[model samples]
Target: MNLKDEKILSAWEEKQSITGVHKITGYNWQQIAKVLSTYGIVANDTHEIILNLYDRGKNAKEISKITGYAETTVHAYLPRVRPAYNENISENAKRIKKYRQNK
Candidate 1:
């Protein structure tokens, strides 16, 4: 690969957002993504990357920063990838319902 392609690949491998890399390299995200795909580097969606990072113990705020998404958006996706989070919410709801019935 040429130096420009190499730089784009390096930035992508480093987990930098496409938009962020584009800002630094002056190439649009589509161009960068096309180069990555050409080299067999499958690009993942921002949500999927966020979920993986969350599984790795990164919080919503940190994931938001890395993925260039709002913290609220990251939090919204957490339940989809984190079964434990959904379970906890369900358990809390059950407990609240039981408490109200008992009272």
Candidate 2:
């Protein structure tokens, strides 16, 4: 690998997000991932990457774009990691009722 590629790989190995690596190296996430794969370096799982991005304050859509997962999938898995907020039992019931009705 060239010196520049080596630096980018080092940054990726340091656990920098694909976005961070892109910013520093000018290589998009897909290209970086492909290169990593060629070196037999496996990337993180979708759920783990999504949760990390979410914890860093990225919304579901942004996380989806970054991680290449469907937004619906991200939404489905997020509630498992982050607690759902309900102002009251009534509000929770109302939401459930609405959801059931929609279904």
Candidate 3:
């Protein structure tokens, strides 16, 4: 972790709100959320998109097509998928896993 992050954690331990931390660090809530998740922080925005797609039962490739992000990128964040969400499968999705996976 960088010095800024260390300081942010210290501030957080002192009960600083995320908005406050963002103000001090100039980092978005998502970036800060990722850091917190690394330490087992459950409330972060981690898996937000993954869960959104997963609930809809969209595969990594389908999510990639819809999101324009690499399938691997979507797959990589699977671990963070929300524990509770819809689990319906996506239909008529174009498979683009190869292009993204090879990268």
Candidate 4:
């Protein structure tokens, strides 16, 4: 790993009270969390706080504004609740495909 990633890993390993990697690297907090997740990091109180903030009416931008999270992090944690977000187009594949093929 590069020096930056090494530092990020150090921060996670230390489990410091708050995210310290963001201050010294291009990595954002969410990106750090994503890395932690990739390595099987368990959920913690901070994760719960993120979930709670996302569950409220606040949009990602609003969550970012209220919380200290980066804008990207707020967005990363706050999608997938809308009907459009959950929509699936693969459900009617057979009928749709037959009609299209006949045409």
| Candidate whose lDDT is highest | 1
Which of 1 and 3 is the better model by lDDT?
1
Tell me the tens digit of each residue's lDDT in model 3 across 29-61: 655555544444433343566557756889878
Instruction: Give the per-residue lDDT digits (tens) of candidate 2, residues 40-80.
Output: 45455764676678779999899888878888766644533
TM-score of every model versus the real structure: 0.38, 0.38, 0.38, 0.36
Worst 10 residues of 3 by lDDT: 84-93
Task: For candidate 1, report its TM-score.
Answer: 0.38
RMSD of each: 15.3, 16.5, 14.1, 9.9
Q: Judged by lDDT relative to the true structure, which candidate is superior, 1 or 4?
A: 1
lDDT of 2 at 31: 61
RMSD of 4: 9.9
Error of 2 at 75 (Å): 25
Q: How many residue pairs clash in each candidate?
A: 0, 0, 1, 0
Stretches > 4 Å off in candidate 3: 44-103
Candidate 2: how large is its RMSD?
A: 16.5
**Backbone clashes, candidate 1:** 0
**C-alpha lDDT of residue 26 in model 1:** 84
Better of 2 and 3 by lDDT: 2
